[model samples]
Target chain A: MQERSEPEAARGPRRGRGRRPTAEVRADVLDAAGALLLERGMGGFTIEAVAERAGVSKTTIYKWWPSKGALALDGYFHAVESVLAFPDSDDVEADLTAQLRAFVRILTGTPAGRVIAELIGQAQTDPELSAALLERYSDPRRELAVRRMRRAQTEGQLRPDVDPEVLVDQLWGACYHRLLMPSLPLVEEFATSLVANLLRGVRA
Target chain B: MQERSEPEAARGPRRGRGRRPTAEVRADVLDAAGALLLERGMGGFTIEAVAERAGVSKTTIYKWWPSKGALALDGYFHAVESVLAFPDSDDVEADLTAQLRAFVRILTGTPAGRVIAELIGQAQTDPELSAALLERYSDPRRELAVRRMRRAQTEGQLRPDVDPEVLVDQLWGACYHRLLMPSLPLVEEFATSLVANLLRGVRA
Candidate 1:
């Protein structure tokens, strides 16, 4: 891990570098990294590559991220931060079905899907990265899913005995498998079918 | 891709001044590579490394596998070929649930899990490798799952309207997400809960 205590050299001081790049600059760096990741894939991606692509200084990147995994996580966090929003309709089944279908489409129809698969793969290799990814990305989505499932159960649309957290895990897991494995196509029709099948057993 | 007409070292004679390596010797090389992959990660693994580990010439490896991806695929195929066996029992729900739990445990509990995750990541970068992975490894399990789900539907355990392929995808996807994402605690209890939830929705 790169030690953070050292006063890193300022990168490309704009007018002698105006006050370390702001959050917007950091966001741009992450966006650049994400785009580079989709283009070059993770194998060829590096901090220098991201810095060059973002047109930011390596020191600026280092100031923001301690390691490549950290940088990737930053990008992942931004990409997936708002993806798991649960529906608000009183009809729990419709709400679950809609959210799940949207989730499936987002994963199968975008570059972020591939990026996420690669990140998950890296997590398998690096335990620290795995921990960070779960905490920064997976946990919040899971909690939101769980909360929605619980709300649905309370509305009498789902079995009260069903564990909301576990159901959410299973739903997400199924989505991951479909996206990464791709042995089964993840069309909207398939998503609707899956949500229906799952609800058949759990819906009260 | 390298032309398939002849081995890269077709001109090279058998290394033996007194003993030439045979076809069996080629299998031995792949076997050694598999062992090395199980022991060492891809970064530290190389054709030269495999040759050294196998006590064979690098020429033999190149003759068999044009790239490291091909070699890694061989290893992965060897490991997963026997890992996913669908139950043949008549009690569809019981058998499916048992198999589901077993699949979850095997995928997340072993080094193969990490290896599979890395391969998935690699696949994102290599389309040919991804196709090969799905064709040889991913599809067989899917085929078996589809077969089982279809059987259940015929037996009236599953609703006639449920699409077998879609249901299998959902189940497999969910388990896969848990394994690769490391978002959910992979435990038998969680698997059981998922099984129950899906069963409620799918059972006729």
Candidate 2:
């Protein structure tokens, strides 16, 4: 968490002598933002705090991200990017099973679940945050999964008539439902079951 | 909406002389609460307003409902009860399709969608509300659908190994995802397609 920004903090006041790459600065800010959000939750997340921790200017952050919600979403995505990455395999079931398992692990084990839950909750009333969530997080993630499913369809692993968008919904949406409703525990087994049931069909 | 409460309001100060039936009084309060929620949302929904509108005592309302959120959920359910009822036709697919279509109509056509969204959003921060939503609303609704699916399984209409609970999530959860995220439109066709896709399976 602090590892990325620590070096930037140590190099304080030497801005003019050597400017960091845009990607590096962006990574540092997002890392700091994600760490702050995970540690303190949304109430403690502020642009000022992120700027200070990342050792970057507030103006720079605003220049890159439109709003706090946007920044928070980007940071959250950045933090979880590696873990939630969609995998492609010859067997669509294997790939989906792997990805959904990883997703359930994050939702059940990590602070990322709570963070995302809060973000979705807050987005209900906040238009800007809603836009950011849809544009930056949900849409991109859905597209990635949809893309994978599309490839599977081409490979004749999935039914030609199946709507990949709805498949995405049936699988991931079930997980999201458990996350939001909480009456059911979101276990990894549920993810595997979701894939198996969808693929095999429920018709006897 | 106001039809249920208008007569009660007209009854005014005649509380002690001719006390209304408990069931009738309960109906009036819930009607008032639902109407208030739909019209003004959670922000304007209050015990006092409901009491005044329903011509019931505050004590009676509290005795029946623990909190504003609980009242709102009950009220919302009462408002949409007839429309969202689960059907038990001979064909499981037809029953599911009919129920989901009705559910989609409420979500898209009425104010219920925004009201539930607001309730869910607030529930994230309010434990009491979350409990009310689960116990009084989500859990019961889920039970109804699951029972219907379980019956289908026993009748050999559904796969024996299929998890009814997961099936419920896959269908209803997808609708909720669209409602909460709003990146996709929640249409009647989507509901029909959801039932069809789930019944037939998505395998090639």
Candidate 3:
């Protein structure tokens, strides 16, 4: 995150301290933000530290994000999108079960899970961040799931009366419940059982 | 929550501050903690503020509760249990529907809901607080739900294969999803709809 943005190749012998390109600056800031967020956590994270580490001005970071929460949220969103994968196989249950296992694995075992938890924690208090996180992060992922579920419906694999929104909510809800409650474990087996039990109840 | 702490009546015209009874002190502390928690929320709340507002020493507050999070959590649990009721009618559906409606109503509308949200928000970070919240607050309520659902099983109203834990988790997960995501509305209609849809899936 303390960017190698210095571009050793460009530094040659003159070793100039000139401004980098706009895209590089943004990448550096987000990377610094992700590093700082994952390292120090939400409580200790700050925009100033990100600017210092990224070698970008606070004005430049603020020009794009508007606030510290927004920047941290951006970092979180970037991290989640990079790792999440969707299933596309013809079998709805296999596609769902496989993708869900992977999805839950990221949420339970990875830094991406931690970042989602942190962002969700703050989104409880900040309404704007809540909207930004959902619209930018949650909904797109959901649309992918919904598209697959509807495909299942058209293929006569899902119940005609099934509600995709509720269906997705139940799956993610269980995942989030496990994430939020330390008492509940979210292992791959539990994900498998949850999908089996829930889908058995709703499958066509 | 300000207790009647009737030493005031007993003290009569003197109305002296001479060492109130232990019960009175405890009640005052909890009331102050509740008031401060409801007003300032978890992030802004502190034991010192509760002590100052309650006219108790910081040592006294510390002696009763181990940490700021614990005291705040106790206040939240007290507030929630006071308003929450258990369902128990011969008709399990009617009983569950009414109680679920009330439970979700509290979750969606009252200060109790906000406190639950705050505790959950922090539980994402603090494992100790997460354990305390689940053990003290969530488990007892869940036990009550399990009890009623078991009775439903006995009466052959719910599927015998239905796992009570999973059944409860789905209901709670959906409610929590609503609580965590402000973009989604948590109205009475939604609660009713959620219960109807989920129960249909799990019914005998």
Best model per TM-score: 2
**Deviation in angstroms for A24 in model 2?**
2.0
lDDT of 1 by residue, B1-204 (tens): 122234636524443322554665665566666667666656666888777655567776777677777777776666555555777877766777788887777666655566666778678667887887787668876788888777777777777776766666556666667767776667777666666777766222
Docking class of 1: acceptable
Count of clashes in candidate 1: 11
Model 1 lDDT, full chain set: 0.69
lDDT, candidate 1, A1-204, per-residue tens: 011222335334431344554865676677777766655656667999877666567898898687888787676556555564677998776777788888877776666676777777667667888887888678877888888878777778777877777666556666777777788677777666666767766222
Interface RMSD of each: 3.8, 0.8, 4.1
Please rank every candidate by TM-score, starting with the best. Answer: 2, 3, 1
Given the true complex, what DockQ would model 3 score? 0.31
Model 3 TM-score is 0.76
Question: Taking the true A–B contacts (Cα pairs closer than 8 Å), what share appears in each candidate?
Answer: 0.64, 0.73, 0.35
| Per-prediction TM-score to the true structure, in the order listed | 0.72, 0.93, 0.76
Model 3 Cα shift for residue B188 (angstroms) = 2.1
- Shift of residue A142 alpha carbon in model 2, Å: 0.7
* Model 3: colliding residue pairs: none
Clashes of each: 11, 0, 0
Cα displacement (Å) at residue B204, model 3: 17
lDDT of 3 by residue, B1-204 (tens): 434344545535323343677777787777777767666666668888887677777888888787777888777756656555655677766676677688777776656667778788878778888777787767776787788888888888777777777666676767787788654666666656556665565222
- lDDT for model 3 comes to 0.71
Interface RMSD of 2: 0.8
